[model samples]
Target: MAAKEKLSGNIIQRSAIFLENIGKRFAAGIEELGYVMVLFVECVYWVLTGFRRKQPVRVAAVFKEVREIGVNALLIVSVLCLAVGVMLSIQGIATLKQFGQELWVVDLVAQSVTREFAPLIVGILVAGRSGSAITARIGTMNESQELDALRVIGINPVRHLAAPVLVGMMISVPLLTIVGDFMGIMGSALFTGTEIDMPLDVYIQRTFEALKPDDIHQGLIKASVFAIIIALVGVSNGFQVGSGAEGVGRSTTRSVVLSISCIVVADMIFTYFLNIGTLT
Candidate 1:
């Protein structure tokens, strides 16, 4: 029994040591991440500077990413928006009806969908779809030594790859949010029509009547911030990718996860600020 106790104690000690080592590695990694973030910011800064100088025109690349990221992301955005609209309308109607405030369903659905769900869902979809693809593409390029070749040839990788994606996302995410808001309203109208005997036109009219300027402004603002986060996180993870195929996969996954996480956190911050403003 004593020997078994000693053995267990030794195992526990080794586990604690291993955990401490992991903690140290994680702390070091976080410190390295700060440096990497600074580098990425500098890269973006220089890319913008070069654009001002016209060393390479950024228009075509921006257009390409808009087409690739925004256009390619439509189906997922549509599906998610539809689901969100349907769920919110159904739940909103059910809850409000129980309180004899069913007419507020339009207001509730429109406000929630337009002001938050639309941008949030679109951001998540874009992060998972477009952002992951961008990460994978960059990771593949890095792994294939294309980035090294660009460096040898005096081409800037950030200007060539990251900037275009960043600019594209800045354009694409807001456009996508607009599309999603429209789709969500349509979905909500359809659901309300079926569930509450309201005509689609009436539901839409009521929804629009309930929407305020802040709703639209906040949603757009969130989309813009989310776009920046998606680009930065995606490109950062991509640039950090290791040499193997698995590294590319991991980087892509991390990009999506980080982008989504950032979006959520940003959304919370926006929500707090907006709510505070509303109260005032």
Candidate 2:
């Protein structure tokens, strides 16, 4: 009976050790991911320096990715924005109507959508849609020896692949954010007139009056940062992929997760900094 008890204790100790090791492994993986992101950003910075010379930027490729990612994503953005806007209007009207201030619905809807929901939701959607696609495309190319072929031909993979994607995302995301804000407002207006007693003109006037240029600019800025995060994370995951189908799948998953995490963190940081900047 003593031996059995001792054996059980040892088993528990071993299991604890195994779990600790697993935790360490996860921490290491996360640290490696952070390092990879830093390196990728550094590389992009240097590539942009070369683009300043007016030769390294691939206009055609950047345009192509922009159209594919931004244009293709419009339907989803519009639908989601409209749905959220309608929901926001319903909730805001319900709460504010009690105060006899249903007019405030416009301000609430506009500010919330432009300053918060539009950028964050669009960022998440872009990360999920375009980010995974970027990872898979680059990973498949790497696995197919295409990247190596580019290298052999004396072309820089970072410039050819990463640059265009990063540039495209940077351009596309801000535009999408603006579109989302508009769609959200439209939806909110629809809800206001149909469901609530608020006049459309009053809602529009309130929205325009409540929204400052800084609000719109801040939203675009957040979207831009999120765009960079998504592109960088996606490309880094692609570059890190090993040689197999499983590797592509893993990279795709990592890209989406990392991009979304970065977007959230960056958005928080941007908001804090913007407030600080305004205060000062």
Candidate 3:
């Protein structure tokens, strides 16, 4: 009887500890979210009002970062989107073939690429690529006390470092999504042309017929939101980095994971709201 009573107490204690840990993590997550919002507002303020300040945002610096973050990433993004497009065409044909609807693969590829896959792929790519880079750069500066040096020189880190990144991401991601959408649709068209002997013109006409302006615009809107999420998450994680190289490494990993997770969640929210809007 005593043994059973002691076991019951242990189980109760373990359950209590588990609940406590969960509550602590929930609180931390909320606090971190607040910090990210503050950082985003600061970054936005600097971008919008920097021209009126004594020290305007340097055009050369912003442009340099844009080239580094956006131009350098283009080839890889293009290749991945092309591959995804081809795969989608192949699988779509296979699935719809049983129903004598293999031709519907054109519609599938066009709508899915324009409305969903292209933006999502670009968002994830940027989150993994530029997001980690931003975190590691800022984190390295933190370790070397460069952030402090900038502060001592009367420069805000968010204005000097993060705003440029945010601008670049916002500009580049939507353009990338557009490019990805085109490449993805073209890939599908090419695959269908070769595999099923469908003429390229017919496939393109079918694709154009299947997609509407709203479908394309939805992807652009999603890409814009994803850019903000990726940039803020990356910059926020970088600012939160601890001391040393190990800290930078950990922060970079966290930035990628957090940015991707946030992008997915934001995408879900956008989808829900957009669906409601469409229904109404």
Candidate 4:
């Protein structure tokens, strides 16, 4: 009887511990969400008001961020989009040929790349690259007490650090998405012209015919939203970093993971609502 009672007690203890951990995680997530929202609002406010202040808009900082976030990422974005385009054409050609509708591959590649793949691929890549870099940079500053020094000097860290990043990302991500879209389409064109024996001009004309203004607009909008999410998550993680190098590393990893997850969720929401009006 005593052994059975002890077993029951052990089970209950384990259950309690599991529940406690879950509750803690839930609370932390809620707190982090609140922090991100507040920071986003504050950064927007600063951007709107910064011009009227003594400092005005930080053009130099914005330029630096643009260089770091956008220009640095161009080559990788091009390569990935090109690869995706080639793969899409190959698969699309194989499947459409089975139906004797190989010409439809043009429409498939163009529409899919423009409307879905390019923006999403760029967003995920930026989240992994620039997002983690932002988090690590700020976390290291936090660890080294540089943020505290700024506070001591009466500088608003959010205004000084985050506003420029937000603006830079907003500008850069959409432009990068445009580049990615072009690269993806070019990749499909290359494959079709060589392997499928389609003429270059004919392929280009078909692709242009298959694309719509709304498709491009929707992709740009999604890219902007993803940029905001990545910047907010990255800056938030940076501010929340703990006391050491380990804390910086942890925050960087979390920033990348969270930014990517949020980008996907936001993309789905945007796609659903944007398509809902046409659902008839």
Candidate 5:
């Protein structure tokens, strides 16, 4: 009887501890999300009033970030998008040729690239590249107490650090998506014409004809939202940085992982709503 009671008590204690840990983790996750929301709202406020407020946005900072997030990222985005385009065309042609609809590859590539792949791929790439950089940069600053110095010097860190990045990402992501869209279409056209033995002009015309403005605008909108997610998540992780070089590294990794996760989830939500009526 004593042995049985002891075993039952041990099981109960372990279960209680497990539940306690689960609750703590759940609470922590909720707190993190709430903090990100607060940061986002602060960013929006700064956007609306930073120029009129004590801290006008630094044009140099915004321009510098634009060069970093947008210009520097162009080549990799172009190359990867081009490869995706070619691969998509090959798959599209292989499937469509069965029904004597090989030319439909143009439609497939254009719509798929513009409405989905371009925005998603670029957003993810930015999340990996720019998002991680945002976290690391800010995290390093925080570790060095530079952010505190800014605060003491009468500059809002959100306006000075995070908001410029917010603006930069918003500008950069949509532009990259546009470039990705163009590159992807051109990529498909380059390979498909030779593979299908079709003229380049005809392929180009078919692509324009198949793609609607709505298809393209949907992607741009998605890119804009993805930019917001990446910037806010990165900034939040930076502000959350703990005390060491290890902390900075950990926060940077978290920023990339969380930014990518949020981007994908936002993409799904955007795709569903933007194409709800078209679902069959």
Candidate 6:
């Protein structure tokens, strides 16, 4: 009887520990979310009040962020989207040829690139690249006590650090998405002309016919939201970093993972609403 009782007690103890850990994790996540929201509010407040003498934005920092997050990322975005275009065209051509509807490959590539692939691919790449960089940079500063120094000098760290990144991301990501869209279309056109016996002018005309203004708008909107998510999550993780190089590395990893997860969830929500509207 004593042995059986001990075994039951052990099971209960393990269960309690598991529940406790889960609760702790849940509480931590909630707290982190609250902190991020507060930071976002603080950033918006700073931007809105920037014209007033009470809170002037650092314009130079904003410009620097724009260069870093957008200009520096252009080549990679173009290359990746170009590859996506080629692959998409190849697959689309193969599938449509079976039905003797290969001309519709233009529609497939144009609509898919503008409405879905370009924005999503750009967002994911930015999260992995720029998002991780933001986290590492901020985390390093935190570890080195530079953030504390800023606070000591009466600087609001969020305003000094995060606001520029936020503004830059909001502006740059959509621009990058536009570039990606153009490049992707160009790629498809090139492939169709070189490999599929389609003329360049004909391909271009068909592609434009297949594309709508709404498709471009939706892609830009999604890109903007994704930019916000990447910047916020990256900066938040940076501020949450512990001490040492290890902390910086861990924070960077978390930033990428969290940003991508948030982007995907937001994409799903946007897609669902858009489809619902279309159906109605």
Using lDDT as the measure, the top candidate is 5
Error of 3 at 105 (Å): 1.5
Residue-by-residue lDDT tens digits, candidate 4, 143-245:
9999999899978889889988999999999999999999998999999888879998999999889899998999999999999999999999999998789
lDDT of 1 by residue, 1-280 (tens): 9999999999999999999999999997797579557756865686668856665636898899999889888887887898888888889988998898877888987888878999999999889888999899999999999999988988788888888888899899999998899888888888889888899888878877899988888899999999988888888788889879999999898889878988999999988987895677
lDDT (CA) per prediction:
0.86, 0.89, 0.90, 0.92, 0.93, 0.92
Look at candidate 2 and tell me the lDDT of residue 20: 100
Residue-level lDDT tens digits of model 3 in 143-205 = 899999999999999999988888888888998999899989988988999999999899888
- Candidate 5 positional error at 159, Å: 0.7
Per-residue lDDT of model 6, residues 33-90, tens digit only: 8999998998898888866846566988998988999999999999999999999999
**Where does candidate 3 stray beyond 4 Å?**
277-280
- The TM-score values for the models, in the order shown, are 0.89, 0.87, 0.95, 0.96, 0.96, 0.96
Candidate 1: residue pairs that collide: none
Candidate 4 pairs with clashing backbones: none
Give the higher-lDDT candidate: 5 or 6. 5
> Residue 102: error of model 2 in Å?
1.6
Residue range with the least summed lDDT across 10 consecutive positions in model 5: 50-59
